[model samples]
Target: MALHLPQAASLPFGSLTKMLPLNKTSSSVSAISKSFNATTSLKIQCKAPSVIVSDQSQQVSRRSGDFKPDVWHYDYIKSLDNNYKEHAYEEESRMLRAEVRVFLSDTVNPLQQLELIDTLQRLGLAYHFKSEINKMLENIYSVDKFKNKQNLHATALEFRLSRQHGYDIPTDVFDSFINDEGDFQTSLSQDIKGMLSLYEASFLLMEDETILEKATDFTSKSLRDFMSRNPGHELTSQVKHAMEVPLHWRLPRWEARWFISEYERMPNMNSNLLQLAKLDYNMLQAMYQEEVKSNIRWWERTGLEEKINFYRCRVVDNYLWGLGMKEEPHVEKLRRVIGNLCAIITLTDDMYDVHGTLDELELFTEAILSGKISVRHLGLRPDGTMVEKRQA
Candidate 1:
């Protein structure tokens, strides 16, 4: 990221002896010539005697090729560099500010906030966003008047983003995102995002595998219980498939979570899901390895697992999109390999879930149940929007 600059020009000079000659006898003339030769020798130092003085254009070319401009010396250069860096920072800050403005402009959810934070991180501006989110949290939490508001839950995005980054989010911050006056059902998708972030943060922020395992085990059980009890739902089949299918054909939650308690219980006993998830993770790791293979020496030198994990997130997210959760498109030319890596991981996750299902859950019982598993909701029509169906 360093800026390149050209070199300065050398001062002009003339042959000292040419303009000052002495009239002399042979001895004096010889002495004069010897002195002149000595002076010329000293001026040249170790350089070859025939070295050419550069022309204006040649000097320019030499400066351009062989030297950088002294950016530190020029007031304008220093000013410009500082201003540009600050401008870039401000541009990112503005984007985050606009995102917050949108959050405040209408009803939003923790999910949207999570999604936004994720976006900021991907865009390399999360640091600037951290302060903006903090200010919003403070503004909302400093008064009881706003505490009872429904829009508070929408702002939970700030709380979750801050919490996930281990950025000191107070309980009051969480309080600001919840409605004191209502039953707390605001944005379903955002709620899901908040729940997922909470689940992830418990593991992510802690960095203790034991804690993560306990959290994972608990979430697994709770999710399973929810799935098991909610049988005969359309989403069950979709959920079952998502748990088992590869990314390209995987189901969205509306289609996947139709069956209730199976998600919680069945996958635990089923080795297929565990293996599939592992396989998907491994495949993603492999693709990441290939990505860094050319720089394997560099990666080993730096111990860049954070970058590796970040890329894995990308793979998982892409798989989610391949399953119909369209994420924002990333257009870096070198990173196109990420899409392929995700495709493989998505398929593997589905296969794992499929192999891990309980015998009873695995058996498609729609015909035998005689509409017991069929959804009778208004949005059950095939042409209905997935978002509407999910809300239903």
Candidate 2:
């Protein structure tokens, strides 16, 4: 149960001391801020908007390629849909477990294993499946019922529900690792890698028409339910608009195609929709910036504040140098975004640990600070609107 994991140069896990430290400003970050301002201030050429004003009659005749088709090509779409329904999850799940087994057993070829890892990652199981994989790894080495295929599958399900992080695990499986405490780090590293893989997997799912459709349907239904529950509220419109606009405007044709395909396959509109909505909002700003870069004055007027906030929200002092990645424009921007994200995560995680190990709290915080989190009436508190309480 205990293996001395090669001490990874202690990763900056939840900071106890630094979370609320003094002056809280480092000189290095200040310099970076000054440089960032100077660079952004440089005069750059802007592009003109693609649309041109024309006569009404001519405009009527001129078809913009913006119209989304009500249905996809029936024949081809049907066959693809049938295939997804028949296969996608079962294949991905089996393949994922197999890949982890191979890694733990040290039986599979490294290159082949990595490819399998990449596939599971692309499929979006990387993180969810990983915690279970680590559990399985321990089981393989320890005394838990690995021979029982049902147990293995149960482990897989627990992982999906966020139980692998010690939520609703079987006592035997949980205690098995407790016996061998040394391998904990290796288990955790595997878990992290797995989560990373799932994050990538989500992107892969994002591109699949079938997956995207299921997600959208799910989001739409959730919105409908939310609205039904709340009779009338001003914020409802804003939330609804946020959900719909991204689905209609921000989601591209390619993603739409995948959404349709996914809908055909899974046909369930569960959490996928929320994930898609979040992804849409997060990526849209970047896409919008790229789209409007040509019109200098327009860019200055519309985009400057957004760009500044985007960077400001993400900037963190430690984020710039940690992880050994080189500093550059995009890197700097990404670091800031990640920093902002982590700050929110760190703050909320404290609450989660205290309140209830609420997985959605992390996801919700992720959504909120990333501009995706929305809340509605459970009722009002004395101070303000009744918001979902975090641990704090």
Candidate 3:
């Protein structure tokens, strides 16, 4: 669902200014003036040695963010309703999850098991089988056959998965693949899958690991050369995507969205797993839509948008930022808290960065430091009433 928001404006500083004795000559005011003068190098020449002239009457030009209006609209967000939220869909998802779990249990080959774990993670279904995955990885790590493996893809995958799950697999795991001159073997370039895996695994390198560093440079150049040589190869797309951004650094939800489509094109893609991923994604998307709507409503009730107009009005963007941090369905409360905090922070940041006058910002900072204003004070209405806090 697409929801568009208007460009945000500055917050109301009147209440903050009123919280302090603006007319009285206090130490705080002198300190603020000194700090501002030091930063701006303003020369104030006054006949009275202790008096400072105020510039409140002067017209001050404010900077603007020049940010465009939000793309997602409130009406569009409210209109979003997917059938995946139905009970029948949830029941079907449970059945598919069970089938996939059984498949995971039945898989015996080490390489296949690693591939399956990688697939589940990429598809964003790993959380549903956390214990099972941990058990599998534990068993794989305990076997300790990575040094004996001749297949570069298997070794690289094993190294990557092990390090990712907190197993301290060492850099020496790649010693067999490196030549005496301390470089990756040139013959390994012919194995595209292995090269891609090495490229991915190289990202897990720690400080001072020169071998993985060399592997990164080697696999990067090799993957580019291979892609140029075989432009129409099935693995070319995956290679190019990997070269752009390694899987280790990608966001879970976004990667799942892209990989699900790519997985559909794979020859050996599991039907049950594919269906489960699709259903799970849609269900989560629907829930996120509701969460965004709730946050937008909260924003409206605060009356901050109508009262102040110089900050970014990005309720949807803020919620999505929270989603990127905690994508699990069960963490709805944490997600909402994060979203609200992000919204408030963005508004306050814009005020300091783009809109607030020097004196006004100082007063706000002082109020915060003196404990005269709390986060709850941010929900104050134009009529001097408090907006009731919403329960998560």
* Candidate whose lDDT is highest: 3
List the candidate numbers ranked by lDDT, top first: 3, 1, 2
Residues 1-392, candidate 3: write the lDDT tens digits.
Answer: 11111111221111001111111232122211111112133222111112323435676766666655554455545555544456765777788889998999999888899999999999889999999889889998898766766789999999999999999999888888988898989999999999999999999999999998999999999999998899999998889888877888776777776677778779999977887886787677667767877777777777776676667777767776677777889988677777787888888898898778899999999998998877667664433223677699
Score candidate 2 by TM-score against the native: 0.18
lDDT of each: 0.32, 0.30, 0.73
Off by over 4 Å in 3: 1-58, 379-392
lDDT of 1: 0.32
Worst 10 residues of 3 by lDDT: 12-21
lDDT tens readout by residue for model 2, 289-328: 2221211122233332342221111112223222223222
Q: Rank the candidates by TM-score, best first.
A: 3, 1, 2
List, residue by residue over 1-392, the lDDT tens digit for candidate 1.
11111111211111111111122321212222211122222211111113223436534211111112111111111121111122443343344456545553352443443444443343223343466555544543343232334443343444445555445544443343334552222342333333333333333333433433443344444434445775775444433332342212323222222222232234322232222222222223233223323222222233323322211112223422332332122322233334333433433343234222344334534332665542222112222111122334
Leading candidate by TM-score? 3
Query: Residue 127 in model 3: shift from native, Å?
Result: 0.5
Candidate 3 versus the native: TM-score? 0.81
